[model samples]
Target: MRIKICGLTQLEDAQIAVKAGADALGFVFYPPSPRAITPEQAAKIIQQLPPFVMMVGLFVDPKPEWVTEVLKQVPLDLLQFHGDEPEAFCQSFGRPYIKALRMKPDFDPEQAAAGWPSARGFLLDAYTPGIPGGTGEVFDWQRFPASESPSWILAGGLTPTNVAQAIRITQPYAVDVSGGVESSRGIKCPTKIHAFIKAARS
Candidate 1:
């Protein structure tokens, strides 16, 4: 499974994730998140990254102007929207994007995935009333559909300890983790990063 290590704030952490075999690295742009980083900060980190590593920017209900401005500054490979953004708004930027779905009790993964026909993929995150993502809590793995058509990414809470089971159960196209491999908020632990990647791939 493809692995994306999200919520990176430091150059060191970014490098560690890359070295540990992460396919993508995420930068949170929403100011409300403790893991958030400015576009400029993200740009600096992106510059030092080796080629072939996808850089993803996470935005939550951002103004179009803000997205435009960030794109001008950071050469992001993809955009991930974690808020209530309409299809038109997400497509306006002409970038391949992923939509995050907050899983609730009444949620249907396949039905939700069908709604975003234009999205590159769907990121399923656990729903916490006020939180957009990174709740560090795993949702019901059985809720994931067995068939993989549009490509689904498993997110929310995932750590080295249980990522293997999660991957086996969900069989997602990719898996995203933030706090799961963290030393603290916004800080990644290299040991955990390596372990998690190894577990997922194994």
Candidate 2:
């Protein structure tokens, strides 16, 4: 399973994730999110990163024009939409983007996949009011349809302690984590990052 550590706020955290063998590093661009970082700030941190480390920029309900503006300033390998963006809206950027599904009691995995055909993958996260992600809440793993899942990233309240189990049960293409590896909101803990990656790979 691939590991993506999201909600990164510091350069050190980004480096730690990279050193810990993370496949991707996520940077939040949504203002309301506690982990949000500016393009200039992200650029500075990104400059320190070596080659082949994928960088993902997370947005929530952003204007198409503004999304382009941010992209121009920061070097991002992928885009992740965490709000009510339609398939056309996400594909309009001409970039591979992942759409987040706030997993609810009634969420249908097949229907969700059909709704966003253009997405490179789907990120399943727990539903929470006020906050789009980084809620540190896990959804019902049983709700995920075994035969209907697309290229997907399994998320939601996953920690170093439970990431291996999550990967074992879901067998997702990748696993995205934020608050689960944090010392606090928006702050990543290296120990957790190392442990999470080690557990997932084992």
TM-score of each: 0.98, 0.96
Could you tally the backbone clashes for each prediction?
0, 0
> Model 1: which residue pairs collide?
none
Instruction: Kindly list the per-residue Cα lDDT of model 1 for residues 23-50, writing each as its tens digit.
Output: 9999999999999999899999999999
CA lDDT of each prediction against the hidden true structure: 0.94, 0.89
Superposition TM-score, candidate 1 onto the true structure: 0.98
Prediction 2 global C-alpha lDDT: 0.89
In model 2, the worst 10-residue window by lDDT is 141-150
**Candidate 1: global Cα-lDDT?**
0.94
- Stretches of candidate 2 off by over 4 Å are none
Q: How many clashes in candidate 2? A: 0
Residue pairs with backbone overlap in model 2: none
lDDT of 2 by residue, 26-128 (tens): 9999988889999999999999998999999999999998799889999999999999999999988778999999887787867877889888889899898
Off by over 4 Å in 1: none
